[model samples]
Target: MPTIRLKTTINAPQERVFNLSRSLDLHIASAAKTKEKVISVKQTGLLELNEEVTWRAKHLGVYQNLTSKITQFNFPHSFTDEMQKGAFKSFSHQHLFEKISEEKTQLIDVFEYESPMGILGKLADKLFLKSYMKRFLLERNQVIKTTAESENYKKYIST
Candidate 1:
């Protein structure tokens, strides 16, 4: 398994950042470049514990569908989502939020995944998969940071 960690500092409340991170609408908007869309969802709005969402998107010129469930959640703090069905052998993402100040917050992402095909997967990760995934995450984080720092967050989050 390969793990990718990313930290983003946002000029916003920790609670707001946390909510935006889990917002379905925000996620779809951020992934517009990949043409990502929701195929199905257990519930809408911000994802809660045990909620599952299926997303269809084009990656590497192939359209794929991935279903993931929120396995752990701590309000305004942290959450973990694991893949139920996807291209990867296993996938898990942890979202953590730390309050830096009344108006500042730190958002952290810990993504761990194992590609299929064993040795082939290892080779793929070393060759390009890791960097590609990192770039994807970076783009998503940038959108989250921008949204959390502005009034535009109101479009995705209610509270």
Candidate 2:
């Protein structure tokens, strides 16, 4: 498995950042370039513990569907979501938020994923997927960071 870790500092409250990170609407909006959308569920709001969402998107010129469930949740601090079904062998993402000050928060993303094939998978991960996945997470986190720092986050989370 390859893990991609990212840290983002946002000028916002921990609770606000945490909620925006889990917002279904925000995630879809962030991935607008990929045309990603939730396919299995119509519910579009903040996600909670044990909640599952199935998303369909175009990546690498192919359409893929991935379903993931929130396995662990510690409100305003951290949350973990694991893949239930997807292209990869397995995948999990952990979102953590630390309050740096009254108006600043440090957001951390820990993403771990494994491809299906044996040696081929390893090669793909080493040669291509690693950087691709990292970029994807970085883009997503950038959305979260920007939203958290702006008034747009108000639509995602209530203060």
Candidate 3:
């Protein structure tokens, strides 16, 4: 499995950052370039622990559908989601939020994924998939950071 660790500092509260990270609306907006959409029934809005969601999107010019489940959750501190079905052999993404101050929060993402095709997958990972996934996560986190720091976050979270 290949691991990707990233940290993003947002000028917002930890609660805001955490909520935005799990917001269905925000995710759809952030992945607008890929046209990612939630296709699972009875799964929308803020995702909770043990909840599963299926997403359909276009990646690498190929259309794919992936199903994931929230395996762990701990309020505004941390959460973990793992792939149940997808192109990859397996994947797990952990979201961690640290409160730096009343107005600052650091969002950390730890992503690990394994590709199929054995040796061919390893070569692809080494050659391009690793960097590609990193770029994808960075873009997603940028959207989270920007949205969490702005007043627009209110549209995703409720009081």
lDDT of each: 0.94, 0.91, 0.93
Residue 37 shift from truth in candidate 1, angstroms = 0.3
User: After superposition, which runs of candidate 1 have C-alpha atoms over 4 Å from their true positions?
Assistant: none
TM-score of each: 0.98, 0.97, 0.97
Residues 1-159, model 2: lDDT tens digits: 899989999998899999999999999989998899999765599899999999999988899999999999999899999999999999999999999998999999999999989899999999998998889888988999888889988887777
Q: Is candidate 2 or candidate 3 better by TM-score?
A: 3
> What is the Cα-based TM-score of model 1?
0.98
Supply candidate 2's per-residue lDDT for 76: 87
Candidate 1 lDDT trough over 10 residues, lowest sum: 39-48
Q: What ranges in model 2 sit over 4 Å off?
A: none
Name the best candidate (by lDDT): 1
Global CA lDDT of candidate 1, please?
0.94
Over 25-126, each residue of candidate 3 has an lDDT whose tens digit, in order, gives 889999998999999984457999999999999999999999999999999899999999999999999999999999999899999999999999999999
